[model samples]
Target: MPLRRVAALLLEPMSVFEYAVAAEVFGLDRTDDGVPAFEFITAGPAPGEPVALNTGGAIVPTHRWSDVLDADLVVLPASEILEEYPGELLEVIREAHARGATVLTICSGAFTLAATGLLDGKRATTHWRYLDLLARRYPEVDVTIDVLYVDNGSLITGAGTSAGIDACLHLVRRELGAGVANAIARRMVVPPQRDGGQRQYVRTPVPECTADSLQPVLLHVLDNLHEPHSVTSLAQRAVMSERTFARRFSAETGTTPHRWLLQQRVLRARELLERSDASVEQVAADVGFSSAALLRSHFQTIVGTSPQRYRRAFSTT
Candidate 1:
């Protein structure tokens, strides 16, 4: 019932695009349908000075870092480089987080926030290209490299540059409602929703399928997830030795073929569990698992919950 106060922390060499995104969504008073308007302010390390941006532009902040203690949400725009995160910046972020403000970061800006130890032991994402580095840099942080973004309640991190828009839209939906977020998306001509599980841009597209390559075989395996197939049989169908087929499959998918196939089966089982009233045994059979026990074992291992619990949690509406 009260106005939400949002502050975007503008650091030197700020990303104008990310900053503009924060302003458009939170700073502007666009409440034509009676949605609550937020009290938005740009804040800098120092009070009331023009902050330099990477887009050859400057924006003067309305407040200093001290004013951020009262903010409900604080956005950290993407940092220009991975190493520019300073101790002062880390302290500001850490203090804001300690005060219970939702700290959100876009792309590599997560690196800066993570420097404060806020994201440690929490699931988060950053630009997918820098994912391995993020994981390596902050081994305590649980990095999910594939998702569009991760929402850890108190802290949110987005993958890549454009995924920042997705995360911001998601925040609008979470804080206001879907109607407000959809209206903003319509105005921007962007898709209203992309699941957090959606893939970011693939770094290097797989080489085009060759006559002897495993792409065709992989497709068939995916299409028939319920089928019982063996490595020997698959290699025979492709007219290659098992070792050669495994090597080529790994090159194409960045994972072993067996692991990929098992993951797909787990995915299929989850869909059935979530969408259908079938018992765990039925879903297991439908997804090529030999038994419900095997299904429950793998489902809990991969989906992080029992099949029955997953079904109950995500039953079709």
Candidate 2:
């Protein structure tokens, strides 16, 4: 399916930000800018009823719950984490998924989708605040952590407010093409893509000179990804002993030098694949992977897809 129709299911008490996120991504017409426009609708239990918002004001949906069934994609904004969601709402989600509609949850909206039992045995996540509760309540679901979003094909879950945008854009990139997603991202002034597996937050909340001082080194490494470099070499360049550099690097980047290097290499490879007419082998070499085989392994690990398939979906050329 090309994802032409989209309906957001709004429930009370409404979450203004997540609802706004859905509206901004799908409700707006972006066709003039080369982004595909969706037949966006706000659906509720009653077509013309008002749903109270958590922030005070209420939103009136334009369509009834039945309208959600016709959508190619169903968006669920954040919902109240009550003892249970409405039976009718849960049924609608199940029916929607059963009919091949992609269901997306923003923030605590995962709780509503989880109630339908569709998320059982599938990897999913909500906001970090609710991860443990979601796992405890739905014992069958494979609850993931530390990631912004999880895409289990038709059922997708976003971590928090901004993650919703990333998830929606990813779906656009997955179905329509990266060009469309890029156009939308540019219009919104956000990154076109962030791997769903990227960490939601770093353990070190405070900024430190260690991370700041390493900026030059990080930038240099990015500029010369094709060159061989290790922690020792990076340490030498930073004018720090290897042991201190290694400790600071972990504190600053939240990952070891080798892992961060691999992540950066994959990111560069993605750009090359999307923007240039380069072979996988060439992209591998350009991004510092020793061979195409090594690039494929790392690309698949970080991106959840092969380079060729990613290019097929995202390539501008």
Best by lDDT: 2
lDDT (Cα) of model 2: 0.86
Each candidate structure's TM-score, on Cα atoms with residue i matched to residue i, is 0.66, 0.64
Q: Give the CA lDDT, 0 to 100, for residue 121 in model 1.
A: 98
Give the worst 10-residue stretch by lDDT in candidate 2: 198-207
TM-score of 1: 0.66
lDDT of each: 0.78, 0.86
Question: RMSD of model 2, in Å?
Answer: 9.2
lDDT of 1 by residue, 106-172 (tens): 8888888888888889999988778888998999999986577789987899878878889988887
- For model 2, name the residue pairs that clash: none
Colliding residue pairs in candidate 1: 127-160
How far is 77's C-alpha from truth in model 1 (Å)?
A: 0.8
